[model samples]
Target chain A: MRLLREAAVIAGKDLRIEARSRVTTNQVLPFGGLVIVLFAMALDADRPTLTRVAPGLFWVTILLAASLAAARSAAVEIENGAADGLRMSSLDGASIFLGKAAAVAVQLVGLELVLGVAVVALYDVEVRSSPVMIVGALCATVGLAAAGTLFAALASGLRARETVLPLLLLPVLAPVLLGGTRAWEAGFEGTPSDGWPWVQLLALFGLVYGSLGVLAYGSLLEES
Target chain B: MLAGVDLDVVEGEIVLLSGPNGAGKTSLLRLLSGLLALTSGEANVLGHDLAVDRRSVRTQLALLGHDTFCYDDLSVVDNLRFAARAVGRSKHAAVEAADRAVERVGLARQAHLEHRRLSAGQKRRLSLGTALVRDARLLLLDEPHAGLDPEGRDVLDALVRDAASDGRTVVFSSHELDRARGLAGREVRIVAGEAHGGRFPTAAAASPTTSTSGSGSVSSAADEPVAGVSAARAGVDTEMAPGDAHEVSP
Candidate 1:
């Protein structure tokens, strides 16, 4: 309970910063929207082709947006050597990871909502199981944010962090991308039963990465 | 790069850590604060072994370095309150400590301004205020006077002096000997990553129980400055990042 409280404090700090900066509203949200527009335009005026590929395109946008959000989350910590204060403070390292991941997960959820609407309006894709879609999204967001926060810690202080972070994070995220896309595909196909299994995969992915973050973030924070 | 320099300070003692840049003054401070692990040495800080209990050491001590450690997006009060909560203070206590620190450091006028909007001197004061918020038994400050105006420096002096009077240990580094000499009960000079000790006439004002271990030795004499003591020369270390100025661990 105490650890969760500490994590909440960290998450609160991050969300408050995001609210003040509106980096998501001004930069990341627009970037996700633009990516969807670009994907729609690049696929060449074929309505069926665009609709068929919307699930994949939607997950792709989420992955890209999540990467950006995760990077920003890490940047917030290192800015002005604030991480040093944290390192020297009494907050637990696992709490830092959980809080940052929670913040990123929250941001990604907001982005997903905006982009989900964009995919439906732009690509003419129809959703089937609303519950499956929401559950899959939550699970995948957790997994992505967990892995993203973990990798961000690894890349925080190294030179070439911009180029290096996605390199470190993207490959690890392949499973989340795959699992999320498949689950959403099942939703688009109007098969809730088919999607439920994929949701489980996403949940499992989230659990594995979240647990790893809680276990290893302290050592990683110290090493970084 | 600290080579076999072991130094100890009992509770509530003010020790001046003096050295030219690149001589490992900052590195030693970070190591003691557990920001950087000791490469090969034994260190006990406030009853916790540095090797096994860094978290406890960090909890008991606060370090103010070149980095003010404020979030640019947050207001001054928010930053302090966040720090207070982070260091495990209760929510009510966190707010109380933050408000007190704001008043103590003379930042109450600018409490609502974002940290990035503050002037450099104001930012320095905010950093000092951050130190004030923590109920730490040990305070580690790295060049607390650099770039401060007279008023800012005065706030820092009061903070340090008050902490010492309240029985808190303080270790700070500075290039100005005259300013620092008056504040520290004892002085430890680091040359080539080795520490040499001395005493001040005001040593009697507080009880500084010290012992030497590893390859470092202590020589205490009231009114005798540490050997090779002089005005601190401004220096820099290319090997260490300016942010973690004294972090020299493998």
Candidate 2:
């Protein structure tokens, strides 16, 4: 119960900061939207091809956006030495991890909504299985957020954090990208039967990373 | 980078850590605050072994470092409230504490202003208020007086003195000797990561010996302008009242 309360406070603080700054809404969202537009342009006049790759393109944009969101979240703590305040706070590390991951997930959900609409409008793709896509997105967002928060902490306090974050996060998040895209592909299909297995994979990925984040955050926070 | 440094601080005592830059004063404070790991040593703060119980140690202490520790987008009151909550205060308690702290630091007028919009001195006051809101047993401040005006400094001085009088321990590092020398019961000089004990004639004058372990005698330099005395007569005053002598093995 205490952990949950602390987590809520942390999440609340992060969300409040983000809301006031609108970094995710103003900057990262537009960046993700631009990525979708660029993907469409890159596959110019190939509507069928764009439709076939929409799921992959959507997941890729989310992955890129997740990196930025995670970095910005960590950067907020770095500003004005807020990281030290966090470390010195009575809140446990697990609570901190959960809170940060939840914030990232929330930001990603917003990004996903925008990107999803863009993909639908630009790729002219039809969603045959909304249920599978929602589940896939939920699970994939959790996995990305957990991994992103973990890697954000790993890269924080470094002189090259901005450059180093993607390098450390992307490789770890390959499973999320793969599982999410595959599940989305199945969801886009007429039958949408095979996506459940990929959805399960995404769920498994989320569970693994989430658990890893809770277990490792304490030690990660101790570093520097 | 610290080596062979042994120091002890007592409860309710204000210990000023003074040294030139790179003297490991900040590092020592960080270690005490559980923000830095000791490579190999035993550290027990507020009855929590730093090696094994860092979290508990951290929970019982508040550290105000060089940074303001305020979120730029959050209002000053929000920052204090968040800090209070972060330290496990209930929502009601956090709100009350934050309100009291803001007023205590004289930031009530600017409480609703975004932290980024605060002047440097206001930000410092807000940071100090955040530390005060935690109501921790130990307060470790690094350069707490850097950007404050005379009035702000006076407020800080009163806060530190008041905290100490209320039986809360304060360990602060500062290069401002005149201001710091007046507040600290004892002063520790860190040179090359090793600490030398000193006595503040104006404060805690009853206990004149240094409080560190394994260092038996204060160097001849103790007679210098600084308020330090040699450690040769240190153990003689071991019988001082509770909270008067903080003798620990650092």
Candidate 3:
């Protein structure tokens, strides 16, 4: 209960700040849309190939979207020197990480919705099995988002933040990307064969990434 | 409302953290108050070890630092509200605390203004106000008087005294020796990475004729005075009345 309250306060404050600034949402939308369009253009705009690659393509776009969005979620707090204030507050590191991840997850969902609709319309891919795909993708996105925000916060105060975030995040987020694409592919094929294992991988990624983010966030904040 | 440090903060004690710049005084306070990690140290703040019971420690302490922590986009009152909620204070208590803190800092009229609209000095005062709103037992201030006017300083002094009188441990750091004397009940001086000795100004030392307001106190180890104050003591007693002079052995 206490953790929920802390997460709410931190996430609420951050979400409000993002809303007022519009920098986060604005950047996520256009960049994510552009990436989806590029995927469409690169795939020869064919129906079957687009359909076959749609799950993988959609997961890839979502991964990039989550990565970019999560990168700034904590970076803004550190950049403004507010991380010190947050540190000084009674909120623990897990609460802080969850709060940041929550906001980033929200942004990713919004981006995914836009990209999902566009991908289905443009590529004529069938998403009758998309509910499972969407859920699996979300799990993977949360894992990536949680881990990405931690690294972003770690790197935010450093020089060359834009270059450093992906460097630190991509290596750790490899599991999520692999599991997410696989899970989404299995779901798209509508057989549910061994998709459970990949889904479990996403869950494990979430737990490991979330726990590590929680434990290491304090040290990162202190170092910053 | 009494707050104790990992080491005791005795009553009627004025502790100083005198040191060259970047001696980790601010970081120490933050760590003790559960703001920064222990890294490697045994700190049992108010009987709560940071390693084992950080949540309890956090509930009992407040930390003030160079950064104001004010949300630049929000109104001053809203900023305080956020802090209050963070610490689990009631909304009414939070508002009351915010009002008193803002009024105490002479910024009552600016409570509704955005933080970015405030000046540097005003920003510092806002940080002080945020600490004030926590209603915590321990108050850890980093350069609390960095940008205060003389009147503002007096108000701050009174607030610190009131807090001490109520048995709250008030700890802060500063570079100005004169101002340090005026603000701290006891002072701890840190030089390089190590803590140096400290005491109040005496009539026969470096500035005998110097007034209590702004005299340069003798801080060197070579010029020790015969005052009732101690030399380089940790773990002060806060409930003791201010100005209780007593001879303390090093």
Candidate 4:
């Protein structure tokens, strides 16, 4: 219970800071929207092809935005030496991991919503499996956040963090991309049953990364 | 970047760490506060082994570094409140503590202002207030007087003295020899990653015109008087205060 409360406090602090800064809303969200528009342009308004690739395109846009959002979240702590203050505070490492991942997950969810609408409108896609699509997005966001938070911490001390974060995070998040895309494809194709297996894969991926983050964050935090 | 450094600080003792730039004073303080990992040394703080129980050690201490450790977008009071909550204070208690800390640092008027809007001195005061709000046993301050005005520096001295009077340990790094000479009970000089301890000329030693009790409450004696000498010789009476449990051990 105490750990949960601490995690809530951390999450609340991150969300409040982001709300005040409007970085995610003003900057990252627009970037995600632009990615969708670019994807449509790349397909040359080929309606059938766009519809078929909409699920992959949507998840791709989210993953791209997730990288930026995660980096920004970690940057907030690194700026002003807040990371050291966090290390000195009494909160446990697991709580910090949970809080940071949750914040990223929240931001990604918001981006996914905007991107989801874009894919449907621009790609002429229909949500035949709404439930499965929601579940797939939820599981994929958790996995992306978990892996992104870990890699963000890894790259935070580097001088090239902005550039290096994507390099480190993208490889680790390949499974999330694959599983999310496959599940969304099934959902868009009106086959919810086929999507459940990919949803499970995404869920499992989230669990593994989430657990790893909780256990490893303390050591990572202690490192110079 | 620190090596072969061994130092011990007792409860209620204000130890000033003086060193040149890159002398590892800040690194040593970070090591003690459990922010940096010890490569191959045994260390314990506040009854917790730093290598094995870092979280507990961190909880028992506060560190004020060059960075303000505040979100630029959050209000001054919000920053303190968030820090209080981070240290496991309840929400209600965090709000109360934050309010008191803001008032203590003389930032009540600027409490609602976003942190980025505050001037350098006000930001430093707010940072000090963040540390003040935590119930940590140890305070690790790095260059704490950098952006402070004369009044702010005095408030910092009083706050440090008050905290020591309440039996907490303070280890701060500073380069201002004359100003720091007055506040610290003992001055530890760090050179080439090594720490050497020596007694500063106490207020009593510098001037015999004034005598103060051992409680360390005499703010005017900051430059010339020492309070813990008697307590150190006789040993701090932890039985008188339940919160001072660390002094009983070692």
Candidate 5:
């Protein structure tokens, strides 16, 4: 109960701060949209080809936007001198991680929803099974958000945050991208999901990263 | 092993940890606070073994290091509210506590402003206020007065005194011996890895049951400084009382 309360507090503060500075969402949304637009222009006027690639394009946008959104979620905390204050509050580091991850997850989900709508409207993509694909996309994004927020905090303390973030983040997030892409591919093919294995893989990635990140955050915050 | 190095702090005792630079004062404090891993000996803080229940110990204690931990991008009030939430408070309580803390630190007027916009003195004061609001039983402050003006120092001094008075154990490390002397209820001197014995001169003012383990001596009375100590250079490891500074190799 206490942990949840603390987590809520941390999450609440994060949401409030994000509300105050909508730059996090504003930056991610346009960037994701541009990626979708660029792909549309490059893929030629082939409707069937675009439909075939639709799930791939949609999930790609989700992956990029989710990673970017989650990365900036913790970036704001460290940049503002808020991380240390959070450390001193005597709250468990895991609670802090969970809170931040949850907020980032919310942002990712919101972004994915927008991207999902945009994909269907602009790309003329056929939705074979809407519900499962949406759930899979969200689950995969949450997994990425969990992992990305942690690495973001780690990178934020480093010397070159912008340069270091993607380097540290990409290798770790490779599993997320792979799993999300594979699952979306399976979904688009209208085949029985070999995607189930990848969905399970994403869940594992989320749990491992979430737990480890929370455990490691306290010691990291101790670093100069 | 350094003789007479074992030490303990009970509630309501303002233990002023004094040592020259490199005296392992901060290291010792960190070890006690569970921020640093111990080399060998076990430490138990607030009934939780440091090795066994470090997490629980962390939940109960608050640490204020030289780093004025605050998020520069967030408003002063938001920072405090985040801290309150981390400690398991509701949003409403967090806001209330933050408001009170900002007021207490004289940052209420600037509460809505970003932390990065604040001056150095304001930042330090803000950090101190956050520590106070947590109301943790054990408070670890490293160089608590660094970067503060005289007026800010006085405000901090009062806060420290009040914490000790209210039965909160505060172990603060400082190079400012005069400031330590003014605020500390009991003075602890560390040289290298060794803890030198010093009398609780102010014990008579409150508790008279102060005692030392091993061959350490206890001083009587409040006004007198700890007798004739060698003066060690700053950052040198030495075990000596407040007035007496001794040097020892680790």
Candidate 6:
């Protein structure tokens, strides 16, 4: 309960920053849209290929955008040396991890929604399975946000973090991208049962990332 | 990274740490703030042994380091409110505390402004206000007087004095020796990472006669005359190894 409250406060603070700065809204969101468009144009506006590959294209866009979201989250703390103050604050480290991950997850979830709609509209695809897509998206978002926040902090001290973050984050997020695409494909194919296994994979990924963050965040913070 | 740092501070007393750059003054403050790990020796603050219960020490202490730690996107009140909440205050209490902190820091007029819009001195004021809002038992300030306009310095001096008078212990480092003496009950000079504490001539000499208001007698919650006792021997105490950067407190 205490952890939840602390995490909520931190999440609230991060979200408030996002709301004011609109980095995710103005930059990340538009960037995600541009990727979907580029994918469409790259396919020569081929409707069948776009529809068949919508899940992959959509999840890939999210993966790239998640990198941007993670950087923004890390940037907030490092600005004005707020990260040092946060490290030295009395708040528990696990709570800080939960809070940061939740913030990134929230931003990605919002991005995924807009991008999902864009995928459906531009790719000429139909949503044959809403429930599966919802569950799968949540699972993928949790994993991506957790991994993104963790890796961002890991690479924060490096000078090449902006470039290094995506390199470190995307490779680790390969499973998430795979599971998410498969789950969405199952949804699109109208075979919800087929997506369940991939949904399970995504869920497991989220759980592992969340648990690792909770257990290791404190020490990571200490070392940083 | 400090050595031969034998020092003590009494409750409610203000101890000033003065030293050359890279002399481990910040290293010492970071250790007390629980931000740095103990490599060899142990130090205690507010009855919490750093190695065993660093979190407790952190809870009882607040640090205002070189960075203001204020977010550019957040308003001044929001920054202070976030800090208040971070320290376990309820939402309502945090609002009240943040309001009071800014008012005390003389930034009430710009309370709603984003932190990035504030002047350098105003940013420092907000930073000091965060420390005030922590309600911590021990206040750790690094070069608290550096870069402050005279007015900002006055506000900071007044707040430090107020904290001391309220029975909170304050340990701050400063290069402004003449002014530091005015706010500190005791002054300890660090040279080559070694803490060598000495008196400020005499309390009366360094008192109003030597400086301005908020001198030793009024601000020293220890209530001992500046010369009544050794300053570093007052509140927090430690005996550090000279050669190996080992620190131990009894």
lDDT (Cα, tens digit) per residue for candidate 2, span A37-113:
99999996888899999999999899999999999888998888788788888778899999999999999998998
True contacts kept of each: 0.80, 0.93, 0.39, 0.82, 0.54, 0.77
Instruction: Evaluate candidate 4 by giving its C-alpha RMSD to the native, one decimal.
Output: 9.2
Off by over 4 Å in 2: B198-250
lDDT tens string, model 2, B129-156?
9999989867888889999999999999
lDDT of 1 by residue, A124-145 (tens): 8888778888999999999999
Instruction: Residues A1-224, candidate 6: write the lDDT tens digits.
Output: 99999999989999999998999999999999999999988885577887888899999999999999999898888889998778767789899999999999999989998999998888888998889999999999999999898888888888888999998899999999999999999999999999999999999999998999898887777666
Could you give candidate 5's per-residue lDDT for residues B1-250 as a string of tens digits? 1223445454566777777775556655555555554333444556555545555656567777766666666788888876776676667987899998898878878889877789988988888877866778778888888888998888888888888788667778788898778788667887654466554544446322222222221222222211111111122222343333234322
For residues B1-250, what per-residue lDDT tens digits would candidate 1 score against the true structure?
4554556555566788897676677766676676765444455556555656667778777888888888999999999999899888989999999999999988899999999999988998899888878888778888889878988788788889999889677888888889999988778887666666633333346332332234222222222211111111112333333334344432
- Residue B15 C-alpha lDDT in model 2: 84
TM-score of chain A of each: 0.98, 0.98, 0.91, 0.97, 0.90, 0.98
Worst 10 residues of 2 chain A by lDDT: A186-195
Q: Evaluate all candidate structures by whole-model CA lDDT and list the values in order.
A: 0.78, 0.79, 0.65, 0.77, 0.67, 0.79
Q: What is the interface RMSD of each candidate, in Å?
A: 0.9, 0.9, 2.3, 1.1, 2.9, 1.1
After superposing candidate 4 on the true structure, give the runs of residues whose Cα lies further than 4 Å from its correct spot: B1-8, B39-42, B199-250
Worst 10 residues of 1 chain B by lDDT: B225-234
Model 1 ranges off by over 4 Å: B198-212, B215-250
CAPRI-wise, candidate 1 is medium
List, residue by residue over A1-224, the lDDT tens digit for candidate 5: 76677677677777877777776567888899889888888875787788778777776777677667766776766653556556546676777778888888888878877887887787876566554566566667667877787778777777788777777777777777787767766766665366777778877888788788778866666562
Ranking of predictions according to TM-score: 1, 6, 2, 4, 5, 3
Better of 3 and 4 by TM-score: 4
| TM-scores of the models, in the order given | 0.90, 0.87, 0.73, 0.85, 0.75, 0.88
Comparing 1 with 5 on TM-score, the higher-scoring candidate is: 1
* Residue B230 miss distance in model 3 (angstroms): 14
